[model samples]
Target: MTRLMDQEQENLWDSVQILSQINAEKAKAVFKVTIEKSLQQLGITVPVFSTIRLSVPSTDRLSQLRQIEKKMREAYAHQEKEKAYEYLVDYIERLSQMTEDDPLVVRKKLLASLLNERYKRKPKWSAKRYRLSASLSPLLSKQVAAAYYTTSEVAKKLGLSDQTIRRMCEKGKFPGAYKTDGGHWRIPRKIFITTPEQDERAEEALQQIDIKNQKAGYVDEFDL
Candidate 1:
């Protein structure tokens, strides 16, 4: 990627030098004058400006900008709330420094509106993704958050039965668990840490599970 970028820059530099030389030669060959004067010198009657502003979006630049917009919207659609928020904030913040003639100026406003609306919804997201989604403010990433795991996965890691984890979550033991609309428990990876008292509670819970399972003619999943 670095090499490709360098090669592209080198080509652009070379092209710029060649074009600059050609333009310099042309400027020396033809003295600059008002368009009216030049037309008068050529015995023409049409009036024209001495300079004209050319505004066009290059193919690569346009494609890159569109790709960014696509990713931003996709993140939102996929429910990656944190990533979507960051993308929205970045694009909207960049809008002010951009010239009005920039190709994406209109898109900036459009995306800003769309993102701000979506951000205001404030979807219940995981720890790493708890963001201030309502504005184009600096991203405040949570200090310790990585990923979301299912209840089953968390149970396996903690050496507890799936039923035990689900029951605990349902009983409000794991407050960090977020249930989706479809009745699925999505637990944050950071929620497993226990206080000393909580650890004692967990031990007692497992012992109770052992007793209950033994009486029910089943095996408890306690590692001890």
Candidate 2:
């Protein structure tokens, strides 16, 4: 959280990002009360985060092919197998360079082949010893939790200036979000909802906020 302020970035901490997958309902309720009061005093709204469409950079064929391979690894790590398969198919298609004639059945087999390589190797790896070194021990350090997105990231995505996002955040437009002592906004990703409904947009963002709070892990928090 401090890192966000240090870099003059947008950093939001909401129920989902805070609790991740922990099911301490009682604790959540208590924290909710405290957080609401804090937000009210700060004049920042909840859902400080919001979705904006960001521009994609130009990619040559070689880079695009590398991205497909990297995406396969990412989707699999996120446990998004369906997406992983899609990436796998994309990889094979690039290899074949024959998208016009390839069939889905063939692509499916290629995807399976990709998965099989990992599945077969999984059992062969030996477990490594785990230890907490003195320098890395919890007693000597304060661990600050985090999510991947930042204020700069959101601005880049929305194709707007960071100052605009920061201004919106400061105006109490996004509830469950707050400005830090240094004036940077701490925003959760759920705050981004691009619906045309004037009144329902906040409502939709709030619903997502609740859903993410109930779930564990940041990997699937957005579901966007």
lDDT of 2 at 149: 32
**Candidate 2, 1-224: lDDT as tens digits:** 22333222111223323333332332233223322322222232233111211111123543565456556655665788788767755665653442223445444544454354334443343211112234455643223113213467556444346886677667754434454444456555443322223224323444455676578445354452
Least accurate stretch of 10 residues (summed lDDT) in model 1?
Answer: 27-36
User: TM-score for model 2?
Assistant: 0.23
lDDT of 1 at 76: 61
Worst 10 residues of 2 by lDDT: 48-57
What is the Å distance of residue 185 in model 2 from its true position?
A: 1.2
Cα error, residue 10 of model 2, in Å, equals 27
Compute each candidate's TM-score over C-alphas: 0.23, 0.23
TM-score between model 1 and native = 0.23
Estimate the overall C-alpha local distance difference test score of candidate 1: 0.40
